[model samples]
Target: MLEAVVGLLLMLLGVSHGVETYCDGRQDGAQCYGALGGTVVLQLMDNTSGISRYQWSIKTTTTTTTIIRWTNNMIVINAIANRSSFTPSDGTFRINNLIWTDGGEYELEIFDSDGNISEKRTLQLTIQAAGYLPIMAGVLSALVILLVFGVAVVCAQKKKQNNKPKEKEDHELTYADVRTVQQPVRQMQKKAETEVEVEYGQVKFPERPQQTVEPA
Candidate 1:
């Protein structure tokens, strides 16, 4: 009975150690895209359990270069010519100012305190030219909106100017709008007659009649 129990325990241990390790770039189609002179970060997706050290390296077609080696509370640079950083607590690695030559397969190895590799992750990194279409499109859209607004304002001003002459012409008054002209004559046979004229638009006329008469 004790032998059977030991055999079951050994089988469970083997099964536990046989679990596969998987790597993901957290990007579309499991590919990481980077730009020239930009920063690239490789993040660990697994939960931090018994991790003690981190090893980051880049594999090119003809060479494999170690970038960083990090242990708990310690960090070491292996590639002195390249700018790289490592966070040991989280097993995260960062590369600064990527160039065209930086494009390669990046490998990350997490080890326990016993120097045994606990997990390994590899991701392909590609560096390409930076994109500027979004920024240029935004600038062009703002320019177009401003141009349309300016044109609308100019058209409104021109329309107002054009309507001014027609308004003035349509507002002209005829002779019937004014009060009628009348003359008052007194009983003097030889005096010359005096007349008064009234105008439109609020001009006051004389109330008293002049004492002049026309010859009968």
Candidate 2:
């Protein structure tokens, strides 16, 4: 479809037009956005020939700090703005290593040739901490993958244990087996010895003894 092709082309090409700047101070009261821990470039003015001195300050809710102050002859960048650079010819200010505390209103005081205030412009700058989400997501994904791999390894070990062959049991002898191994009596005695003799007899009685007893 046409939409898909357009989307692919947009991805292949970049989002930049001729120049990229956090804020443009061509007019007064401009607003700018910068990413946290990133860099921001500002176009302060079209030309810096008429300006004698340029003083830039950032104002927060509680305090205000001078970031950079420069003149046509000498340029002095503050310690807090150590990573910042400015071009006097084109009035472009580039700041690096942005933080959350850097979000506030910035005031640029421009002085004329006679040391008179020519223009005092204030621009609102907001810093977004949007660069860390992708990092956090990637770490979470890696941890999830490691956990899944560990679980799979443990499951594989258990399956290997289940599929392994069992060992054979030892064969021990029982009481019945011991009895069968002993020798049994092959034959009994044919006759037993007699300790005493047994006897059988027959007796006859006289008849005369009965007649003598009748006379008496």
Candidate 3:
């Protein structure tokens, strides 16, 4: 049971992390461009438990539908770091300034502490055509705006839901002013009773003593 509970908690935490990362578009693919011969930084994630090592390489396909390792073209930009790894810890890798020949597919391989290897993740890097960056930027900006707007709407709905009962309570209290109106009616009734009592006391019983003597 305890193991199950721990597993459940881990799953929940993982899901929450994924949601936060993806909602902000942070978990998406790493971006690199080969325009004008600039270096592109690529990031790698373990996406699993345990310490891992990372390797990066590039390859090409032959016309006969076979992949050939390009030993001469392979570049080791970084060595295997300890445990978890992310690329270009400080910043992006810059290619040779203004070179167009650097465009290719970059591959990242991960190995677990137990020596279990993962399939390589590859990113296609291409030199951008003129005006391509602007279009990509606009699309990314629009997606961000839409996500922010959706979150705002959800928050507003929650706030309105929380305030609904309070508004209803205020309306109910306003309508219950009947108690205040009845207070004056009670006071007026008491005042009328006092006036009647005063009038009765003012009327004296006359000749009560003479009537008593005649009876005697």
TM-scores, one per candidate: 0.51, 0.51, 0.35
In model 3, what is the error at residue 36, expressed in angstroms?
Answer: 11
Sorted by lDDT, highest first, which candidate order results? 2, 1, 3
TM-score of 3: 0.35
Per-residue lDDT of 8-63 in model 2, one digit per residue for the tens?
A: 44543332221223678667788888777777888888767766787888987787
Model 3 pairs whose backbones collide: 36-98, 36-99, 37-99, 38-95, 39-94, 39-95
Error of 1 at 196 (Å): 24
Which candidate should be chosen as best, given lDDT against the real structure?
Answer: 2
Each model's total of backbone clashes: 0, 0, 6
| TM-score attained by model 1 | 0.51
Total colliding residue pairs, candidate 2 = 0
Question: What would the per-residue lDDT of candidate 3 be over residues 136-209, giving only the tens digit for each residue?
Answer: 45455655666676788899999999999999999889878978888999999999999999887776555245
True lDDT of residue 85, candidate 3: 28
Error of 1 at 6 (Å): 75
In model 3, which runs have C-alpha deviations exceeding 4 angstroms? 1-131, 175-177, 204-212
